[model samples]
Target: MPADDFSLRKIAIPAYGPTLLYGLATGAILPVIALSARGLGATVALAALVITLTGVGSLLTNVPATIVTTRFGEKWALVAASAWCALAMVLAASVPVLWVFAVAVFMVGMAGSVFGLARQSYLTEAVPVYFRARALSTLGGVNRIGVFIGPFAAAGAISLFGTAGAYWVGAAAAVGAGILSLQVPDLAVRSPGAGAAVSAPDAGPAPTVRSILRSHARVFRTIGIGVLLIAAVRATRQAVIPLWGQHIGLDPTATALIYGLSGAIDMLIFYPAGKAMDTWGRRSVAVPCMLIMGLGLGLLPLASEATGLLLAALLIGFGNGIGSGIVMTLGADFSPSPGRPQFLGIWRLLADIGTMAGPGILSGVTAAASLSAGIGATAVLGLLGAVVLWTWVPGRKAAVGSITG
Candidate 1:
């Protein structure tokens, strides 16, 4: 509970181990799946649909998953989610038909929604308020580590065993993560007047899912807007970067390296940024970071070579690293209940929606105009969002000592 006790290695490893594995599997298989879908007689748009469908599934299940966790417990929900994800991965690897694979991906997304909501909610409750930023940073760092490693591993797997083989590896990893989830202790929701020794309240007449949505309307709306902006930024890059890389004569490996290098930079800065958030306040970091992200996105179209691309990657990585912790910390700070899983579900739903829409929208824009135009539009949107955040969100000066309570 001490302020200094929230070091990255100390808090992050335990909370993020299962998540790391999940991310590893997700990141590793993404490129391989897209390429394979195309190779397997699917069109370019159909190949992309695999990714979009997954996000759609996540958006659909986010709220339901949260309700399930609130009714059950975070630990149980996580275990179930992990198991489901593992099963989905197995189906993805084994199924030969494209539609079947799409279904599997969708199920994986649903499982991801549950797992993400539960894991985030658990961290919010388990970590001390003063250390929230550090904890979130640690989580982000580990998640990025998985991203850094997953692609290379997947690429290697593809070379050795082929695309299906890569998916098999992903399946194994998911199952391993599910096994690990069983070991994590269930975090209790903190309640006023209750000592740390108290157990969670027994499940009662559960609120209808609709009631839960209505209850958290304001929080959901704010989170939805922010997540949409973030998603747009990410989507633009995901959709355009590959084409841009091809345009610049970079191979797939080089493309992967760009993302990996960016992830590495992200890992390096995440912890420090988290610490700064706790000390300096969330808004102080988030607003500027968002604008910086916009700048980085805008610069990407101008990059002509490896070095230029790398520089763009670094700027984007650092900017995103700063904002990621702030958003997670804010979610925890503003949750309407100690039942953090429910709130996380709503929060994640918004994010999933943005992610689902981002790639498609960016792709359309690029088709209509150019990659530069798409990236420019995303950058402008990011800048607008940053301005709104600065004006609307509570500032550091107002919340400076608020965590001390």
Candidate 2:
């Protein structure tokens, strides 16, 4: 296959459709999970815990998910994982008890672990080197599109049918994505002699997960800080932006709109960001992405009104949009083929830790000092991340070439 052809026509064209459906499920239910917990008689604190189970669920099962994906290949694993996610949504819709609902959300998270790792591993191998960045970045954008649209779908469902309707929206997305996943080929397990057709070279012995981790310890030690920082700041943006809007005295409706605007801008830049990373280099995208986010967070305290908040939000969104899949793209670059799934499972675990931590960091910092102080802290973290990317992330590009090349 021509290098650009697969990136432009084959992989992305097929992927965005299912991801949109999956995104609907992902996007729709998160906003309402706490409400659903509330209905189940959860305490205010417990409601937060219930909603958080989704990530907790993922963290619990990611390693097993790696083994499962490695055994079944990306296609079957995704199909099964989506089915599992759908079942969890169904349980969440049907159950009366809050604990059951929490279990359902946790299952959704576990399934997410499987689907995410499988998809990343598949993309790492299926697309050629030159096109890999473009493909992964586009995948990131597609997910955002789902997230961007999911809330509206949830709201409409609630507007018409009430809160349980939101769960149904999630169910449909999981089922639809599963069915669509079936139509995509199992690239990893294709027939013998087919490897050459797809340009898959024979890999050496399949390394144990531990051995792979041990071998790449230095790469992880050196590059992993930048990766962890990126994830933390991105999650920080999602949590901080809304809280800051509310802190500045905007009602929930206006806060939602500000966030919506950010999402729109972030979604718009996925392709271009991916293109630049593929064309320029990883650091080209990574550096500015963090710096812009840091700067945006720093400016949030200055926003006393909607226009000011939106402007800062837009800058952060643009920074995040351009980032697309900096972590995953880099993970793909670092993972050797022999044990890619295992390596990615660990890689994603560390990355997910950042996501889980971001909200807590913001919340704690805000409680300790002030919301302004919290945002300032993230700004400093973002700038520090930029410094790390510049100093530690290894792209000394003369022009648009691979750092590892």
Candidate 3:
């Protein structure tokens, strides 16, 4: 297809339909993983530990996922990963053994890594630069929309089945996602101006993953640092709000309502954020996102009343909402064609590390000092991310060189 003829609406079903199903599968299962582990006779701490296995699985499988995506192509990778995840969900649902359940959870995480990378790599190739941020941001938005609705579906399923009903729902969604993946077309989209896409089927053999990392070391060391900090800040959003709500003595129901409200606000801003990125520049949104989130976190300790907490939470949510696909958009911005999958693998790994570290940082600080201190520390990371992004994420004239150079 000619680049000019392409529009995001043209491929919406093929591009995002599978993602929504996959997200629903994930969302349905995540809320109940701990409950399932507990039912299988895991201790509280062990059940908690089992939850971490998802992140661990994604961390371990990232680079390998790149190899898989490259070897089989994005469409097949998505299909295989969806099928694998469905089986894993079935195992989780049917298994009475704790260890087996843990293994199934880990497999789901591994599948997630592959599924995530494949879709991201595909979108990076299929969309043009002018529409890139909007495409990716919408991708993020739809995933969030799926997740937002997943728990309600899980609740209905649980009423019909049992505690494992969520797993069954996830399994069904995964199968649906796999079916949808078969419809994604293989497009040969242009790079920035005149270059061919790196991952085109007819292209020559790409560089080894190690060599690609070696070549992109500076990119990783510099802007990659900013990416990590951004992920870390983003990760803390869920934890900080509820923890602070509890600290201030709000009841569980009220706390949940507040959290849901924030999430609702967070879901509403993806398109406007993407439009801002395409119109003004990445920094136009990136810096303000971090700044607002940082300010919100910094203000958390002062929120003694529910109203105060709600306001602070809304601020943080708005900040996060505007940054829905900033990470993926940035990854797409800098990726090289021949090694795009590998580079994105490394990109996702950095993000995963940040995601894990965010909570750890908060916990360590809270344990040693106070909840207020831990939140303050995370707020600092957000500000640091803002500064780093302002320095590295180029404006319009330099946009073409933002990451590719």
- What lDDT score belongs to each candidate, Candidate 1 first? 0.71, 0.80, 0.88
Residues 127-164, model 2: lDDT tens digits: 77677778888888888888778888888878887778
In Å, residue 282's CA in model 2 sits off its true spot by: 0.5
lDDT of 2 at 351: 80
lDDT of 3 at 393: 82
Q: In candidate 3, residue 186 scores what lDDT?
A: 69
Task: Output the number of the lDDT-best candidate.
Answer: 3
Q: How do the residues 123-204 of candidate 1 rate in per-residue lDDT, one tens digit apiece? A: 7766766677777777767777775677777777778877887677777777777777777765443441111111234355
The TM-score between candidate 1 and the true structure equals 0.87
The better-scoring model by TM-score among 1 and 2 is 2
Tell me the lDDT of candidate 1. 0.71
Where is the poorest 10-residue window by lDDT in model 2?
A: 191-200
- As a TM-score, model 2 comes out at 0.92
Please name the candidate that would achieve the greatest TM-score relative to the true structure: 3
Q: Quick one: ranking by TM-score, best first?
A: 3, 2, 1
